[model samples]
Target: MIIAVGSQSKIKVTAVKNALCQLGVKADIEAVKAHSAIAEQPFNQETRQGAINRALHTAQLVPRAAFTLAIESGLYWRMDAWLDIALVVARFPDGTCVEVESEAIVFPSSAVEEVQRRGVHTWTAGQVLQEWGQVQSHNDPHLSLVGKSRADFIQDAVVKLFQTLQARHLLSV
Candidate 1:
């Protein structure tokens, strides 16, 4: 079986591979750079659509892929504070899809505000945090804040997505 992942990020690719391995799935994994077409700091619905777009976009790029997967992380405003979550969307060849999210973590409102204030389309929440010495960089952010690697969140989300699809009998692979 061939699985295509819509991301060039090593963390995401490895997380998906790790999740599939934990599920006892053996297949060829492909990673492609696909745009999410959402805001640099996606929130709410943008997060969901970003994941879906990545999955469909990757599937379009890799026609022979048995399954296509993509992961998107964004913040949600709830109870006065912003919560960050990772949303993973997986698509089957027939255009069927399932989605799952990682546990939400607290995101500093200051960072969100800074990004919003900058009004730059290229700025991300992570980058804002990085500038303020919150994290090392835009790549592996969870480590400093949550003490968990971003890969951990993505891996868990992928597993949840896989299990959800399996429970619904939506995944044949």
Candidate 2:
């Protein structure tokens, strides 16, 4: 299967490929440069909108791909906590469409308050991690603890997340 992800970020591409591998699916994965104003703040409409925008944009760019995926992670605040939820919008060559969603990882109140106190508000998950001290120990400050790379401490968390998604059949059509 050809899985074309609509992002040039190597971290995201690796994560998606690894997630697919764990699901026992062999796919030819590649990254494409697609731009979209994806709202980082979690809301159903914004989440779906971002995914759709990217999927369509990338599909237009890669007309020959069998499958394309535009995945975005949005963070929503709920009761003094932040929830990290993933949204994926997929399209097949024949115009078959599927939308798969992942549950939220609730961040502690302390983390949320610290973020707001810093006056650093951004929808990007990488930015949120930097606002906190999560990247302090890493040599590469931009690397996400919850993203691609095996040495990341958050690998287990990510793996468990994808497995959960698979178990729920979120990856299936």
lDDT of 2 by residue, 1-173 (tens): 56678887665676677666666766687689876575334354666777777877788888877767777665566566666556666776776657655545554446545545554335343445555766543222323444433223223333554465456664442
How many collisions between residues are there in candidate 1?
0
Backbone clash tally for model 2? 0
> For this target, which candidate reaches the highest lDDT against the unseen true structure?
1
TM-score of each: 0.93, 0.62
- The number of the candidate with the highest TM-score is 1
lDDT of 1 by residue, 1-173 (tens): 88899998988999988988898767799999988999888887889999999999999999999889989998888788988899988899888887788988888888888888885367888888888899986776778898998889889888898888778976545
Per-model root-mean-square deviation over C-alphas: 1.5, 5.6
TM-score of 2: 0.62
Candidate 2 CA-lDDT value: 0.59
Per-candidate clash tally: 0, 0
